[model samples]
Target: MLTILDKYILKRYLATFVTMLAMFVPIGIIVDVSEKINFMIENKVPFLKIAVYYYHFTIYFANNLFPIFLFLSIIWFTSKLANNTEIIAILSSGISFTRFLRPYIIGATLVSIFVLIMGFFVVPVSSEGFNNFRYTYLRTNGQQAMRGDNTDVYRQINDTDFLYVNSYNASSKTAFNFSLEKFDKDKMVSKITASRIQWNPADSTYTMYDYKKRTVGALGDVIVREPEKKTKFGFELEDLTPVIYIAETLTLDKLTAFIDKERARGSSNINIYMVVLYKKFSVPISAFILTIIAVSVSAMKRRGGMGMNLTIGIAIAFGFVFFDKVFGVIAEKTTFSPFIAVWFPNFIFGILAIFLLRNAKR
Candidate 1:
């Protein structure tokens, strides 16, 4: 039971969304190329690799900015409809505002599903490539970037085991000043120290250099020393080296498991990871929220017409981005809950959408 009006509005909504994405993605590419062309030329990166990198970059950019584009497009098209008296005409034809919103809701639902898929699967793969290329070619130094807060790694391997490393090189799979401590209940059982540790991929073991171990017992303590020792620990090499974008490269299920693993390890930056996890769902849900807000704000005929609606839409979109960033930083820097930080803007804007929709209906 589809009406002509429903199909018309739905088609326009989706068409405008795609058109906006098409327009903005090229601009993004041009600006990014202008900024990175020198780096590509200096690095002597092949044209094919550069093209592939930008392809990943396009997916990353579009996925990240979809909500902003969605909001703006809805405002643009709905405002035009208002200016042309189409909204009034439809209302006079006995179509209620609530009925008019059906197509928009359907469109938002479709976009939300797409966003969800992108967040859970597509974006992660693209983000991995995007970050890999940026680090490999765009960064000035050959040094691979580490997480800002993860320098000098330390973590609990399990209930009875703890680990520490003074410095680590991800590319080399090596660490310096490695220490592992084991405890039995409240008593210290043993401690191992090594001058350096390197992963032996062939054996799936770590080779510890200048290895020393001390075991404590009721009667006495025993000490052992070795020049080098190959041993398997409870943790893997990937556990020792964590990158800033590690969370961005995991799917929803993997990210959930990762957060749990990091929590068990007593990681200090768990909040940052939690933010990424929550944002995957929040960003897509924001599409529905923003669609409502956009339609509410722009579905009224006004003196300034489409220009005024677009201006308001842009301002609101920027404000949403600002709130999201500020609160996310607060969660990262302070003790604020990541769940609240990730969803606070949506909560605030959802209320705005409700208020605006009511006013528009009146």
Candidate 2:
């Protein structure tokens, strides 16, 4: 399962990764502290909390940069080996480039696995702490647990026919215009429109005042009368939190749920949400593909030294970033599928990796 060359390459790469992390962590902390220093001082934030937030921010940044690290590490290690003619010696010994690639691929696989597991699984668990730490420390604190106001956007929270107001003003929570739409077997059964909605913290039910109602028939007709007022929608208020969570920040499952809810209500424009969902998964995997491409490009040091490879690496990284954003903007604005937008960069680079790897044989 483990070859000597593989172990050597891994050891080299691991040393590079550790060096990068060692240098990066303190730099990361300093940069984060600098960025947030004024906010913390102004907000009277505690030192301990600021320290924790810095760690969280560093983790997020490192996770994002993992692919670049993979690329650079492989490039530097392989380039040094190539400079010393070590790779030539290995090749002269009858080791094909394909055989050499085994170790690199294995190392990349392990890194990719580690990155994915941490990004999707671990970071989310710590997001609450990280975000709260920042929010608490920042000089300007936004309103939390918004109590009330009039005229708010409502989300049909779940399949149970409950709606959540995005932000209700405390001044007049009662007159807020939010409602719950009830459906049965793909037919609109009843609509509760509220002028003012108030959440009962004791029991979690929302009471709407000065509201109205409408019932629709199965055969595309009105089943019953005009809207009514003072309707108390009996559902848990906190169930609406997921709906109110902003589009980009929502996790995969929450976003899927939101999408389903919106679709059921015949929402036509969901391109932005669709783009977010696609980007979430594609962003991490892009690292793997980009890493492969970077290694392939640098491994053949027939011409320039490390400087040339570094320049090439930076260019490729920016190209990936640029195209990724362009596709997202296009997909969000047009009818282009989000899946295409998200995966296009990866596909292009993956092809590049294959081509470069083939050409870079010693």
**What lDDT is reached at residue 145 by model 2?**
20
Candidate 1 lDDT by residue in tens digits, 76-102: 999989999999999999988889999
Mind giving the per-residue lDDT tens digits that candidate 2 earns over 1-362?
A: 87787799878876876676777667777877777677677767677766677677777667656656666666777778877888878888998888877777666677767766664456554554454454334534554322231124454544646463544432222324566787776766787665556766665456656656676755664534333433335444323332222343445576688677566655444676777667667766775676668667777666768788878887887788788889988987798998998899889988888888777763
**Which candidate gets the maximum lDDT versus the true structure?**
1
Number of clashes found in candidate 1? 0
True-structure lDDT of candidate 2:
0.64
Error of 2 at 314 (Å): 1.3
Candidate 2 matches the true fold with a TM-score of: 0.71
Quote the lDDT for 203 in model 1: 82
Leading candidate by TM-score: 1
Candidate 1 runs further than 4 Å off: 141-154, 159-203, 206-231
